[model samples]
Target chain A: MDPDTAIGGGRDRFPSTEHSLLEAAAGGLAPEALERVAALYWKPVYRFIRLKFHKDNEDAKDLTQGFFSSALERDFFARFDPSKASFRTYLRMAVERFAWNAHAAGKCRKRGGDVAFEPVGEDAALTESPEEAFDREWRRQLFRLALRDLRKLCESAGREVEWRVLEAYDLAEDARPSYAAVGEQLGIPETSVTNYLARARRTLRKLVQDRMRGVTSGERELREEMRRVWK
Target chain B: MEVNSDPADLSDSVVDHLRQVAGLPDLSGTRYELEGEIGRGGMGVVYQARDRQLERRVALKVVEAALAGEAALIARLEHPAIVPIYEAGTLPDGRAFYAMKRVTGVRLDRYAGAGRPVAERLRVIRRVGEALAFAHSRGAIHRDLKPQNVMVGEFGEVYVMDWGVEAVGGTPGFRAPEARLDQRSDIYALGALLQFVLPAPAPAALSAIARKAMSAEAGCRYGDVEEMLADIGRFEDGLAVTAWREPPMHRVARFWSRNALLLWLLTAYAAVKLGIFFWPYR
Candidate 1:
């Protein structure tokens, strides 16, 4: 079943920007909208090509850039049907098919020009199947984008202490410092550290949920995606 | 430090994502300094904090930014069974949070499973009932009452936490099958709590009380928490409970069950007397 149907009759409760991006993509790939969509999905696409297709990093990066550059010119996103599949699944399938066609035509020529996408690391486990690799990379990208947004929010709001506390307490868990230690480092009371961490966590959860709207079909899918991303 | 090549776990990924996000300095201007996370639920995350002015530890429940309006309402509830909210306010980032006494104890279900005597369990339940009774008197209904929401404190304090989600989200298994939740719904949850605390094959008197509280028809349940508390009190004092009318045969059977060994010896003596009486004839 289409995940949208499971989320109660495809009522789009997400913000209008996501819908507008798709509409623009369908109406003839407006440059600004296509760029936004590309920026959002490029990391996942590049990682999928590198890990799933076994292409070297440079070739994978060039192919990812080439696919999006061509997809914009050829109106690739117009083919996406919300009733058929989620945007994430559709994009993954589209990228995979693009890779196969490129290899078939022997046109794997470098054409990235000035795209400058982030490099795909070699750390992804090779044991995963293509679908698993695509999904893991996609979720990782979503997390990366959401984190970027959260940083912007914190910077805008001047909550740097809360952000630092969260970084020390949550992100540095391998060598996790006690709240008292973080407090001493920050020159604040331990209780303040705890409060800041809680605030940061709550804000991050909201921001991640907001970012998930672009890919999820509806509220149910959004919730499911959030659970998977944060699980 | 060596970085692991494998992908980060879900929790680690979340933390990494948070770290990457732009952070803000401490913007809250509250009296309490947060210590650490105490617990979390569907509505909010609670932190253990120290109230600087009061010089005491408190559980600060920071609710979702959208649900900040509930903090004041929850703060108004002043009952021993309910965690008393001392202060409520919005953080600089607009999330709603409140401070209440930090209850140090396990959840009710965990406390019940600790092999405590039945009397102790009943006493704890009674205290909880008293708390609920107080809330009901103040026209507050704890629509989300459950074993998890009830805290059994270290010094035998019974506190019912998480009143923010009252009349909103009900636990699937504990909620009554009612169109509109009211005091009866809380009563049903209390009945469920009794079943959770009582061991299998609970004594007939207590089971009857639980059954009446969990009656399918709302009208058939106790008139109020006070009535239920009264029945529990009666049971504790060895008086006949109002929940069930004991039939003459049932009472006799219960008495016999309670003193089975003594009854068996008396019966054996009677049988021997009869046998001796008949021995002369034999």
Candidate 2:
């Protein structure tokens, strides 16, 4: 099956430029839209291809890049029906469909270009359900994205203390330090430490929710995805 | 198009901690203080919290499955059998949260399993149906009704819960096949709830009522929850139910069973009068 097989024919009917691919053929691919979609989904897509399709790391990376690149070229995201399933479920189903097509095609050739991620050669076994693992990887990436944004926001706004406190309190890998101790190290009172921690966490939560909102349009879908991400 | 954030120290523990912080409801501006998590559902976590101003413990639900819709819907619905929302507002993260009367009770499914009499379980369903009736009167359909969404208190208070306003969603078995929800759709779920409550080898009359209400065609089912409750009322009163057409012998048996004591007294008096009337000495 070719890339267009995932979406049925009669592509000439869409009324707006919002459904790309046809628009991509006219102007060019929407690079920002394509990049945002790929940025959030590529890790899970790669991991899912490796486990569910039994593809090697290199092949899974190729399919991951191929699927997203093709997704833009064929107006895949616009065809999603939120009523039938959540976007997460829809994405999973689409990845499986793409993988099956690749398997049937004997080999899924590299579509866009070389993948930017290096495949970890040693760790390839499944430790959990592939769907759950995919969800976890997606969530991990979401948090990573939010964290990255939090750092940039803190730096730009000259609120580095808030980021440092959040990093020290919530993001600590070892046993977290007491509020008083963290205050002593950061040269602030314990009360200010408490206030800063609350402020930073509040910001982080909003940032994470904003990231969630970026994916789905509906309020209900956003809330459901919020619960799912936390779970 | 590029992958980053690999070496930034988001290990499993860090992820768990970050998720915990994200899930925590920020109650800085509210009158409630979080104690701990009570439980979670499809929507969000319910926390056991204290209302410092009211000096009462309330169940605080931090909404995640909907924006403000669930809380607002719940706040509008006020019935003794329906759980009442006391106060609602947005959390710091912009998710809605509401404080409600902290109900101490068993879910209807577990309560039904505890060797209770069939009459007692039927009564629980009646209260649930009444709550739905009140909601319907206010132009709201529960859309999702099941045994799990109902709670039976120690003093027999019934609280119908988890009233979220949404579209095209429900638990599978309890949900009616009809896509568009109306009063009848809730009737369908109540029927399923009744079926869940019934013990195996249930009374045939009650079983027939459940089956009729659960008919695949929505029109074939009870017109509304109140109408269904009336059928249950008929069964409880030893009268024929609208759902089931009792056969000739069963009707006779039921009549006899209902009037057995009076019939025996009348028959004995008539035998004595006849003996005195036909006595040879007279």
Candidate 3:
């Protein structure tokens, strides 16, 4: 828990929120918005199935896809009442309810009949509760989304210097380079390394907050989520 | 530069590092070691950082380089109430920052909320007024003066924090309708700040001063912070203020309140003299 990880991204909207996702579901379940939700949430859903339902990797993967397809067809997300609970909590409960009913009925949906998404890797250290696992995976997938967006941001906006600074300083695969060394490597002033890194980090923070906003129902929920996860 | 749609497989440590980097203002190249955040505002976040070379704790206002003019602004005017900037530089993360003496105390809003006597609150607000006056004298307008921006220390010292030198727009409630930042806008903020610090049953004279300072029209407000402070001075001294036309009864009451000790002594003396004069026809 880094002390610096205090919740602070004010007003940065990248994509949308869970409210819009529900609205999209109501409006014939817009495929694009649903796909974004699936991409962002598939890992969390799969992890929840694996940890909570005691499913093997293949079963969890199949159930994960089935859950999304089933929820999509059944209009599960549209029933979210923001006042009752957070979208995250609502989602977790929905998954649990769906899994229990399916397991009791001795039913298995045909595989490969749903939205395709990246599978959650072997997180064998499931010493924590299922809820905690789902939340952790949610945060991890959030970072991945932000990282993916950052890559696109740098490319589209020609922010290569900022990206390079972030890579050399923070995302260094090996030993992190010194500012002077990075400056020499990039053929820019030593000071510019930090300047660019600052820009990149600011952008990254906004993206992360934007992702947080996308999952939350409103500004208040987004702030609560930021505090819950970051702190 | 070669662009990839995805980041190279991010490890757990990478995510951890990203979390720190996203929230923390990296100060690797600078002497200040960030302890924790003090607070944040529109301009930037203020962190309680230790100046390694000086071996003392200072507040580092870590803001974007574009919004880092506060250092130079404070540097120009050396006033006791204005938080003094010690050094200014760019953090390793490239955000421009300025290190200043970290005055430990409650914000004016919190301090006011503590239910201090109106006179005590008035004294602190007067100091805040003086600070704004000094800045205005130096041809600089605070453009953002509110209870939250003023710091009241334990030793009864007040420092106006968060100059917001680079910020064009002030906070909503305090800011005047005037779009431009000027001395009058600062006066408007000062009035709002004055109103915030005052207790609910604020005295008529003092409330009048705040009301004049916070007048909707720019010209209707104080010509300068000095004028507002002068009216505040008059209110404190039990003299007639320019802002309010005090009725004779309220004026007499104010006079009595301000000179209670002297008036009490005079009344006692007059009673003794009258007792001696009327003493059995002596």
Name the best candidate (by TM-score): 2
lDDT ranking from best candidate downward: 2, 3, 1
Worst 10 residues of 3 chain A by lDDT: A2-11
Query: What are the interface RMSDs of all the models?
Result: 8.2, 6.9, 6.0
Better of 1 and 3 by DockQ: 3
Q: Taking the tens digit of each residue's C-alpha lDDT, what string does model 2 give over B1-282?
A: 111222244666688878887678878889999898887754568899999998999999887534467557657888999877888888777778889999999998789985799999899999999999999898877777887789999899999887756643689998888888777888888999998999888878898999998898998998888889999999898889988888999999889888899999999999999999999998
Question: What are the per-residue Cα lDDT tens digits for candidate 3 across B1-282?
Answer: 222224535556666777766878777768888899888765567889999998999998876554556557666678889888898888654568888899999888888885598888888878988888888787777767788888888898999888766443578889888776788888888888888888878888788988998888888988987788888888777789999998998878888888899999999999999999999968
Model 3, residue A195: distance off in Å is 15
TM-score of chain B of each: 0.76, 0.90, 0.84
Interface RMS deviation of candidate 3: 6.0
TM-score of chain A of each: 0.76, 0.77, 0.77
Fraction of native Cα contacts reproduced by each candidate: 0.00, 0.50, 0.27
Q: What is the lDDT of residue A179 in candidate 2?
A: 89
TM-score per candidate, in order?
Answer: 0.58, 0.86, 0.56
Q: Which stretches of candidate 2 lie over 4 Å from their true place?
A: A1-30, A104-127, B1-7, B42-44, B64-66, B275-282
- Tell me the DockQ of each model, to 2 decimals: 0.07, 0.32, 0.14
Show what share of the native A-B interface contacts model 2 retains. 0.50
Give the per-residue Cα lDDT of candidate 2 at A60: 76
Candidate 1 DockQ, CA atoms? 0.07
Q: What tens-digit string does per-residue lDDT give for candidate 1 at B114-215?
A: 568899899888887887788777676677878899888888888888774434448876788886888888888888788779987788889999999999
lDDT of 3: 0.74
Q: Kindly list the per-residue Cα lDDT of model 1 for residues A83-187, writing each as its tens digit.
A: 566677877888888889875554335444433344335466558776776666566555545545555667789987876776666666366678899899889
DockQ class, candidate 1: incorrect
